[model samples]
Target chain A: MTVAVADVPAVPPDLLTVAHLSMRFGGLLAVDDLSFVARAGQITALIGPNGAGKTTVFNCITGFYRPTAGHIALERGDRSFDLDQLSGHRIARDAGVARTFQNIRLFPRMTVLENLLVAQHAKLMRASAFSLAGLLGLKGFREAEARAMSLAEDWLTRLGLVHVADRECGTLAYGIQRKIEIARAMCTEPCLLCLDEPAAGLNPRETAELSRLITSIRGEFGIGVLLIEHDMGLVMGISDRIVVLDHGACIAEGKPAEIRNNPAVIRAYLGEEDPRAGPGSTDAPGAGDGA
Target chain B: MALARAAPTVSSGVLRAAFGEALVAAGIAFMLALPLAGLRLPINPMDSVIFRPWWVVVAVATVFLGRLGLALWRARVAPSRRNGVPLLDRALAYILPWRRGIFVAFVLLVAILPLMPFADRRVIDLGAVVLIYVMLGWGLNIVVGLAGLLDLGYVAFYAVGAYSYTLLIIHLDLNFWAALPLAGAFAALFGVLLGFPVLRLRGDYLAIVTLGFGEMIRIILINWSSLTGGSEGITSIPTPTLFGLTFTAVPAPGETAFHQFFGIPFAGVHRIIFLYYLILALALLTHVFSMRIRRLPVGRAWEALREDEIAARALGLNPVMVKLSAFGLGAMFAGFAGAFFATRQGFINPSSFTFIESAIILAIVVLGGMGSQMGVILAALLLVLLPEVARDFAEFRMLLFGGAMVAVMVWRPRGLLAHREPTATLGDLSRGREPAP
Candidate 1:
């Protein structure tokens, strides 16, 4: 149902281009005319204060919500996905856009391996011929199943979850569950991966492990990563680029060094007036329209 | 050391609590059973009433001793067993090692049961009834256990299958073998039709809608007198033959019945044994087919959907296709069972496919443990055969059944076989391989 809505061909510059993206819940403009680009093979951090529209932007891009108005285009290797036009599941299935929840959402009763195998459901189902061929243990179905298992095992090992592969997911520690969620999303082999607050409840050690995992995921996998993180330390440590948002509109977008020094970005986090608060601010052009 | 120190006070407190509980239990037992146990019912033929006061003391003493023994056992074994597996669980694990062997042996026995010295006609017939329910349970297991869809109207599919066979074989003059698949197809069609509207509903709402659908089909079958024969139902339906040869008392013109064709004597046991084996084969087929499906991708998808629908959707699974496949496949099995039921009885009616049948099938699935094929068989035998054995108690059979069900639930809330394994296991990763179990 979601795939059918992707009728228009759309290709913007870069892996993902959010052009004039706007979202509204009733009167609240959760994301208002926000625009940014995330290049392929880079970790891009979406940072803002507590109520910033970071998660909302992720939700709209993933097609969980019908944006009030916007153009969110994702360009895969040979194809481009008009994310705004695609619905929720098609965005993940067809557009190669995968996302993790703010809270971990692993299939708890299923084993760690099963959780990852389930991520490759579409491909296996296609090869299985509605499971009749699989039931008979046909060659094609067996090969497909073997491929799915290896992919799952690969992701599990990368996330350091292979030891607990046979254990049900719910029994695992919270930090491990988070990694499994990321690994499960990775099993989909998406070009663009969106992670929501992956380090929310981790300790300093686990947070460091998460930062290393995220860095390796980008480096080894060569995929664009859009991360929503509250930990400034992990964000500044791993991000190649940072986009700052306040309320619903973008205040600044640039390299981590430039973003870290920007007066408006500081003011958004500190929530105070400074000598550089006005139009004199580098990226903050009075919040309305810098355009 | 701290645990050891705390153990003394904890043990003393436990003992005091047990003493207090036993005293209260004894008091309650005495008051409750005083009149019931101590007094004779209908009095005697000579007197208005006869009081046996020592009966009350016996009741009180039994409760007192039983409670005290239970308390002491809980204090002693429960504490030590806390850090260790319980004996019941250990026994289950002991059985687990031989589970596959046990299952094979059980199936072998079932196969040769009709030939067994002790196997009477009534016993074989009862076994057939159990097998029918076993088939039904396996079918519903796909929808409810694997797909995680709460479908309470699975019996509707059974009803559809039976009616389809009745209409096709008798009315349309189709062969029983040909009508079998046709019956299953009709049931699958109904499954898909019912599955479409309730695709978006979850949990209790899905259950209620399916329940309504079941009732709706039964009501229609009742009111459509011309088509279904109403409450009177269709009769004299042709039974399934062994390759067009009937197992009959009187041979049809130009037709050589089963016994004559085989050159065996025309004994009723021949028909009964044939029917038993027919159902046994069907049940075994359903079991083997479902277990294989469980290892396949679509089966894994059903499990994923069951665990969490949002997660399944996130995996890019087409929920509609997965859910419908479960419904269609499950209903097909139900259809097969229903056709067999019709053939076995040579009569059909709406009353035979009631909500009670659906409930019993579901109870087998749940009590057997959701998704476990072997659990379904065990549950079917327990639910079906236990009541028959308890028939000596007559009206109390149901009460005994209810008590046993309650006891099993209290013992294992997650069902009998709660252990789960991953759907797929790798031989080895490309690198950094862990040894396979």
Candidate 2:
């Protein structure tokens, strides 16, 4: 089911284009002159060591942070949204961008089903006529509620969380909570899904399963997947393209095989004195060279 | 280590620890009661303090014995009980299973209480008062419990409702029924007004701002003498009528008295009973509305915002609108209760709606268990009736109330009924599968 990198069109349509993005927190420039492109139906992995401004890029793309200087554009057919100009919520609501946090952010007291339904709030809220129809249990609202419920059930079953669908999310196992977060984000039906460190605290088997699930989501939904992950095995295995960041700048960007051999990427990761001295050394240029 | 030791030695050690702890408790109690209980101030400051040593002795002994019992229970009975189950938890387990039945029974009892022979005029009036608080508690439950917004100025909306009705009747010549909804609408308006400024605040900050807003409204009522009559609140406020029938001993000319319309002799108790039922119906409306809205999308959004605001915003939910809606709806119910208050008492002043009133209502929501409907009723009854029942111990009534609150907090830190059931279930869907156990 995986498409070879060589099979990709020379100019694939860009779902998200973040150019010259710079985010400064007071004196610290968290992200500096970062630029990247995530094509539709492709898994783009943003990988770097801790504090490499990988999450900062994701934040700017998802409208969580206003970049000091940059353009973050999300193209959906005929329409394009400047994510940097929109508020945090509107970026998700109007622009169709959904995201998951590094730390799990499920509504702990709410049931898993409720958490998923909440992700579909914008649609259900409109159907309920701001709760007037829901209050009266009108046919329109009931049908909408049923549709939302089925969507939640579909995600729960797919994620193997059906057994704990009615349980409070906080009471579930950590691995299950991670899966629920992904399910919740998917329920929003975003054009681009940004997952910040999706496999941070998972076992090898769970990480492998996550890789497969993420690939299937990309293939089945035809949505762009922008992932910030530390698990190198999973990242290199599933990513169609990989973007490497170091100290808030793009160090290298290319196919997974190229990134694996790029001397700058190895030097950024291993802190090697010379590019040729690293384990996976290659006669490649230094940082800030985007392929 | 202690449990493995000899039985006699363990018993002796337990006794010694209990006695030491009780002695310390008695010493602390003596120190506290010295100025308050042992010595009392006479009316005149010139007079010497009147010493009441017996009061001090009684206080110390009560503390001593209570502490001794608690210490012994922990050291001796508690360890063995832990192997099985604690008495309180076991009792709760038994009661929790039949909570729905208990709730229905409680409702039935209250519904038929006024008709009971034992329910005198005083009892009915007290019942009405308790129901008013119950309605207020439930109204605040929406904001404080489900939305997780700490609103200390809920009384502002209540005051708004009361004043709205009273002024509408005075200026516009409106009847009670006509003014009730308007009063609620005015309170909701004020709720939204207050909500706008404090939308960014949460927890303690929100509490402080709301507390200030409540006081601001009360102060306005006190200062704005022209519209609100200042400190001298509007008096001779008209009581509510059943249709065109007034509940008066002698009907005004061209007015039909309630008893005359009913073809029965006039009795003051009839008016009291009517007021009781009126407040009961209003409280039930508040209860049913809160319950229904709990399952709605807006309700879920409130709860979702409460759990995690940032995460909620990220998921495309507007925190501003969600918070405002909660504030508006919560205040609407408070307004309804306020209108009822003004009509029932026939007089309302700034003194009636104070910070303490807000505290009492918040206490009921908390002590009852936040967001739990039945818990609010139980807590309102306990909080309102406990003081009235302890009238004989006028000097110690507040003391008893505070003690009961402390005991409940220590035993049930999450409130009396903290268990929450999800608003929707998977089994409700037509999946043709049994719900997970």
Candidate 3:
């Protein structure tokens, strides 16, 4: 039951490092000593069973739920922020960590474009004195507004949401709404993007599009994408590195190929399926993959 | 009810395209048939129109237009992709120099209304008061409508503004104009102070705290007799003047005050007209300011916070700052109205600034439609005017008011004129094809 911290590899000199991150809710330990490094310009996938604490890790990292014990350090070019010490919104605005909810939390009443502009609120505040200076026509105020609008428009075009840019987010289809939510998150131009189940409700085609979108975002935008997806197809396809968690512990970590065949991962997927002679007692296909 | 059903999800464009012409057509036609209906002019309409009512020309026109609008849609238009009208289709889009239209029309209407023989002096005075309420409602709308924060103690700021003006002008011998801005400043400062604590509280908790805050201010106004005159109210407070020409001028023997100035009848009606314009300008200013703010990024942040706090926070918006600004800007308007209220009446008292006043202003914002300046103004007029118009129905007034409010809410839960949040880029909703899921 006691997993030694030293067993994990040394923390990488990456933009974000979570060392010994553990979150417990009363009797239930949601995330137990889960540690991972998110390098810049890469897609990192955290995949696990329904209750495997992938989202719990996201919540802990995003400051929605403060972990019981953890160290989350976020490094910019020169400055570093103690992510664990920051508040939820501060994690977003200050640490440049933006996240989209699993449930697609959008300002449904607001227009699609307004959703994006609002995401750039902090930057806009810096440019405009909370819009008062913008009103007074201060120098650079107009440029900031144009920048915000252009950024919003860019995301809208990228997501193919140009048509519904003025439409209320509530009125869009579930898939489109999800895309808008992601676009809104990107409009913040965060250093790290944490997407909780972005592909959860998407159809197969939509999921494929989402995969391309995530990959392009990392490759083009030069930002780290941390995704918690239930769809193994997406995780297996786009993720450069996969972190597998089982019952709040890191059961496996490597390239997708290595994690796919890890015996511990197989056992984690099918409990009581023997770690020894695993191919014989099969619940479904992929039982032999552990070989 | 049937008409409401037909236009259940009607957008602002549909209403504008169909409502104005329909209202005009219906108004004329209904007016012609009034004699046959035997409803008289029905000087002031009543809620009894709901049950015992014989209708009027205007009423019939509204019904007829509503029906025609529904029929036109059912016959001519096929189901399309667009959800709402584009901004280009707006009326202001059609006209040149549209900003001046409302202002010019307002000035003309105010100037001409008093000149009409049928326009009662009392009615003009009532209109002036309604304008003040419109100003207050627009101010409150910024807080409750745009920000989606329910403020029940808004009258506290109003009281603060009024007292600041009254006490400062009287005790310190400051000019009415000078105290006015200072009153607004003090009230706005207090708004920020109030915003700091109550910003964390949303919905009913925020309401209760504001209500408490309002009551605290009122209790102070009453108990602080040495300064406030303690319910006796500082009377004989000097009314505002225009270039040394006071509303009241001592008549030479048989000559009236107006005679001394311009050889006209001195009925004190000119003062009411001046007050009307003063408040009209204030209300217009409030409407313009709110409209401008609602289009800005901070304004969008307020709305985002209103809709989803979690999402707003995720967007990197500081909710505390947004909420406080809502309170600050909203209270500043209320403060402006409060200063005007004190100067207009030349009297200050605790009872005049009550929780009920706050409720009525809030009610106007709710009934008119939150986030709609025009809707707020219309609601203010309806709520304020209807009560005054129903002086004959005094015993049943409250019942009728409550019933009408309930009925309106039932018919339009969002408000009479719900406005969509403005976006930076207008989307073509028709092109939003929903892929089969």
Clash pairs of candidate 1?
none
- Colliding pairs, model 3: B26-B61, B30-B57, B31-B57, B81-B430
DockQ score of candidate 2?
A: 0.61
Complex DockQ per candidate: 0.46, 0.61, 0.42
> What is candidate 1's lDDT per residue for B1-437, written digit by digit as tens?
46447665356667789889999999998887777677775634766677889989988999999998898788876876788876778998888878889989999888888888999999899999999999999999999888989889999999999999898987789987899899999999999999999999999999999999998999899999999999999999876788778888798898889988888889887888888989898888888888888878788889988888777777787788889989999999999998999989989999998999889999999998888788888899999999989999874588679989998899878777765656665444444544433
- Candidate 3: true interface contacts recovered: 0.70
TM-score, chain B, predicted structure 2: 0.94
lDDT, candidate 2, B249-288, per-residue tens: 9999999999999899999999999899999999989988
After superposing candidate 2 on the true structure, give the runs of residues whose Cα lies further than 4 Å from its correct spot: A1-3, A9-11, A274-291, B1-9, B43-46, B83-86, B434-437
Best by TM-score: 2
TM-score against truth, every candidate = 0.88, 0.95, 0.80
Interface RMSD over true interface Cα atoms for each candidate = 2.9, 2.3, 4.2
Which stretches of model 3 miss by more than 4 angstroms? A1-13, A273-291, B1-111, B243-245, B250-267, B421-423, B427-437
Worst 10 residues of 3 chain B by lDDT: B428-437
Please report the TM-score between candidate 3 and the true structure: 0.80
Question: lDDT score, residue B21, model 1?
Answer: 94
The CAPRI-style docking tier of model 1 reads acceptable
Candidate 2's iRMSD: 2.3
- Give the alpha carbon lDDT tens digit for every residue of A1-291 in model 2: 124666766756899999999999999999989999999899999988789999889888877788999899999878999999999889988898999999999999999999999999999999999999999999999999999999998888787778888899999999999999999999998989999999988998999789889999988998999999877777777788999999999989987778877878777777776445544322222222222
Better of 1 and 2 by DockQ: 2
